[model samples]
Structure formats: structure tokens, C-alpha cells
Target: MSCLKLNNLACGYPQHGTKNSELLVVNQLNLTLNDGEIACLLGPSGCGKTTVLRAIAGFHGLNAGEIWLSDHKLADVNSAVPPERRRIGMVFQDYALFPHLSVKDNVTFGLHKLSKSEQNSICHEMLSLVKLEHLGDRFPHELSGGQQQRVALARALAAKPSLLLLDEPFSNLDVDLRRTLALEVRNILKQQNITAIMVTHDQEEAFAFADVIGVMNDGKLHQWDTPYNLYHQPNSRFVASFIGQGVFLSGRINKQHIETELGHVACDVSSSVSENIVSENTETHVDVLVRPDDIIHDQNSTVTGEVCGKIFAGTSTLYTLKLPSGTELLANFPSHLDYSLGQEIPLSANFQHLISYAKETA
Candidate 1:
């Protein structure tokens, strides 16, 4: 059985108090998590990611559908098992460790069901799992932000809950610390074979931590897929624009390729599952998603554009190119090859296939 299953899940708060109309935050969303799998819900703020997390944790009652954990039906409109009784653990954004409690005590809080010796053993194991065995005596306030986050994780895992939920657990840390702690936490969770679902707006963290990612927008799941597929084959243009940086050049679907002002390019047009512009009439408008890496600096190619802007990255520099049509495109060039603004440079497409979508209108 799957560790967690959500079916046709719909939830919303009453507009004020009356039920005449509910402001729906989660709508007809279905998700399934297998045993020991780590999934992440990624989206911008106010996209119903947190609403789904709260619903799964039993904080908000569902307006429709059901939530199941393995064989147990934890929630439905008729009833909701209290969050405490669901054997589900949560690591809050603030690292909600009790101020007065020592790390050992904090880790032991949820292990009350076990014997004293058993609780101590589990707490010690959890501490070791989080690499905090040396700081068990310290209180939450005594530890650094990273340490405090580790303690919160240890406490959550101490009880060995059936599932773990992390709600932006690294949001409070700095950028470097966020990535370090996120990778460390992923290691710890995997070592324990814990099934977890994390909510985050940070793409880097989600990519580093999750085995599967569900990209959501406006309460709807756009795609539930691997990180690779989400990057390489985004289900919607929203995902393409949101997940990474790219420029879409307007073009038309031709006989066997896409005709554009830059040049004629050939790729799998069938990849555009949403847009079928390749009928008997090949004059359909489409936009090609040209990622920075897809473009390369080539002196031999006839195609060229003026350098609009540049950013110095350690290993490579990002160059912004403006086409003759005044469309902006980006390409990453070697840091050693410096190019100045307003200088026209030759370029070529480096990718084997191109991604396109039906052109958006003003």
C-alpha cells in the first residue's frame, strides 16, 4: 500500500462564516506516495502548497474527498483523526523546539509511548542520525540555527512516525546554510527510510532533496514527476517559466521544422503535447523555449545578435542577446571569453531538441 494517498481532495475556508461560497485553496488534487519515498510540493507563495500540507496534517477539514495513509483512512468530510493520533510527524518552519527543554528531552517528547530505556535509546539513535549526539545536553536556544533545525528533525523522527511533513524547514536559514542543511536532512531521512513530503518555494532545495516533485499552481497540480522530467519536459509553460530561466522566441510550425527569424531548426514537434500546430496548414504561431545552455557562442554560424547584458558567474558568464526582432535571449559563455555590451556576436543552437508552446497573445 502507498504511504499516503489523496484522492479528489478539495478544501476551502468559508468566506468569513457563511457557507454560501467557500474560497477554495485546494481543488481536485490527487497525490500518491509510495513507502519510503520523498516528495516535494513546489510552487510560489499562496499557491495552495501550504494548504495541502495543512490538510494532510489534519489541521484543516476537507470539503470533499479523502486522505489515506497506508490502510488507514485518516480524513474525510465526515471526520478527521486528530493530528496527534495519526502517527504523522511535522517539523515546523520555526523549528518549534521547546525553549525550556534540552535536546534530549525534546527528542524524547514524542517517545512517551515507549519505555524509559526504549525512549532513551530511540532518542540517542535519532540524535546520532541528525549528527547531534555531541550536543544532546544543549537547549534549543543554545544551538545555532542549523543545529536547532537538526534538533527539530531529530525530535520528529524520534517517535518513528509513519510519515514526516516538513513545511519550509530551511526558510529561516541563509542561502549557503539552506543548501548544506537541506542535503544533510535528505541524507538523514533516507538513512531512516522515512517517507516525507516537504513544502518549499526554493527550487534548488526541492531539486536537491526530493525524489519526486509535484509542481502546483493556483491549487491545481500541473505535474507530478521526477526533477529531471520537470526540467527537461515541463507539462506547461507555467512550469517552464517558473522552474528555470529561458526566453521564448515567436515562430511558426513548418513542414518538418520550426521557422524563425534566427534560423530554421529541427526537433521533435510532437513534444508539444498541448499545442498541435502541425496540421495541413503549417502557419501556426508558436514560441520556442530557448534555455541559456541551449545557445552557444559560435563565430562560424551566420546567426548573430547584439550583447545586451552580462553577469559574471564564477565558472561561466551569462550573456543576454537581443535578436533583430528585439527579442531578448540568454546564453552562458565561458568566463574567459569576455564580451562587451552592444557588441554583436555570432551564436548557434547547441541543443539536440527544442521545446515549444502555442504562442501567448497580448
Candidate 2:
């Protein structure tokens, strides 16, 4: 049985002094989560990632469709479960720790229904799970940002909720700490076999922490897929642009090849590019997505491009190369071979497969 399922889930916020006026924030959202799987809703601000989280957590009643936990219906148009009754745990971005409570007390807050001894037992187990057993007695203010986050996670888990919802949980931490703590938290959730859904705009964090990721764009889900697929086989141009470092170059598709200024890519580009690739004159124009790694600095190749710009990125250098036709492309070459600006260097594309999009209508 699926641990969580959203079927055509839609929601909107009501405008003041109006019965039918609502600004829709989520539209026809559908996704499924299996037991113990970690999923993430990833997108930019105002894209409804957090809105979906809140709706799933029972903070908002869906204007359409249903939410099911396994075989049980948790929410719908005519029926809705209260937040506390939904058995969903949430860890907020701010940690939301009670200043007056110690770490131990905060962890046990949700266990109030249980007996004192049982609460203490659960609290200790949660603290151990978060690897903060020694700091259980300290107040939230005394703990570091990461430690406080751990405490918040422990408290959420102590309720033994059916699923956990994390809303930008690591955004408060520094870059290095965010990476480290995201990995650690993922391990903890996996070890406990906790089914979880997180909301984050950081692509790197989503790749590191989630088993599957749903890419969102303005109030809609573009794709719900593995990180590898989102990066390599994006369903839409929006996803390709949002997920990675890429620059789109214009190309013409003829039979089995896409002819770009860089070179000819011998592959069936239709399936990866867009729907209905055929049109008049036996040719279709497409915008090809080329990553930095796709184009390489090749000393032996005859094709040469002028070095227009460069960024020294530690292990690898990012170069902006301009073709003879004045089209610019990005390439990642080894840092050791740094070419001066305005120098012409031989470059080659090792394209395994081509990805392109249909030309947008004017």
C-alpha cells in the first residue's frame, strides 16, 4: 500500500469579502509516496512547494480531490481531518523550539498523552536517534543551530506520526552545515524507516536527501521523478532550466540528427526535445540544452572557438566559448589548461544524446 497519495489535489486562498474569489496556489497536484521513502518538493519561492506541504499536513483544506494515507482517506472536499488528528509531524525552517523548554522537554512535548515513564523512554530514544543524547538537558538557546534542528526533528518524531513533513528545514543553517546536516538527517530518517516529504528550493540538497523529487513551477508540478531523471531527462524546458547549469542553443533537426553551430549530434532528438517534432519543409527548429561538461576543450579537434569568458571554479574551469557564428557555449575543462581571454582554442562536443525543445510560438 502507498504510504501517502494525493490525487488531483487543488487548493487556493480566499480573497477578502468574496465567496468565490480565490487565488489558486496548487493546481491538480498528484503524487505518491511508498513506505520509508523520502521525497522532496523542490522549486523557487511562490511556486507552491510549501503550500503543498501545508495542505498535506492538514493546515489547509483542499478545494478539490483527495489525500489518502495507505487505504484511509485523510482529506477531501466534503471531509477533512484536523491537523493534530492527521498524525503528521512537521519540522519547520526556524526549528520552532520552545525557549522555556529544554531539549528533553521539547522532545517529549508531543508525548503528553502517554504516561510519564513512557514519555521519558520515547524522549531518550528520540534523542539517541538524533545523536544528541548528551545535550538533552540543554535549552534551545544553548544549542548550536544544527543541534537545535536535531532537537526539533526529535520532537517531531517522538509523536510516532505516520509521516513527516519538513519545510525548508536546513535553510537556517550555513552552507557547509546544511550539507552535512541534510545527509545526517536523511540517514536518521532512513534508519527509523520514517516516510517523509520535504520542501526545499536547493537542488543540491534535494539530490542529496531525497529518493524522489517533484519539481514545481508556479502552482503546478512539472515532474515527479528521480534526481537523475530530473537532471538528465527533464520533461519540460522549465525543469531543464531550473535543475542544472545549462545554456540552450538553437538547432535544426533533420531525420536523425540535430545540426547546431557547435557540430552535428547524430541521434533521434525528437523524443527528448518536445512533442510533435514534424512540421512543414521536412525540418523543425529546436533549442538544444548543452551542459558545461557536454562541450570540452579538445586540442586535437579542428573546430575552434574563441574564449570569451572564464570562471576559475576550484577543480574545474568554466569557459564561455563563442562559435564562429557568434553563438556562445559553456564548457568545463581541467583547471590546469587555462586559456587567456580572446584566445582561439579547439573544442569538441561528446554528446551521447541530444536534448532540445520545440521553438516557442511568437
Number of backbone clashes in candidate 1: 0
Q: What's the C-alpha lDDT at position 58 in model 1?
A: 89
Model 1 per-residue lDDT tens digits across residues 180-278: 999999988898899999999999999999999999999999899999888888878898888878988888877667777678887666765255546
lDDT of 1 at 149: 94
Model 2 deviation from native, Cα RMSD in Å: 1.7
lDDT of each: 0.89, 0.90
Clashes within 3 Å, all models in order: 0, 0
Name model 1 segments beyond 4 Å from true.
17-19
Model 2 lDDT per residue over 1-362, tens place: 58999999899999889998888899999999999999999998999988899998998888898999877899999998888998899999999999999999999987878999999899889999999999988999999999999999999999988999999999999999999999999999999999999999999999999999999988999999999999888888899889888888888887778888777888765475675547546788888889988898777888888999999989989999898878888899999988999999998788755678887668
Which sections of candidate 2 miss by over 4 Å?
16-19, 279-281
Best by lDDT: 2
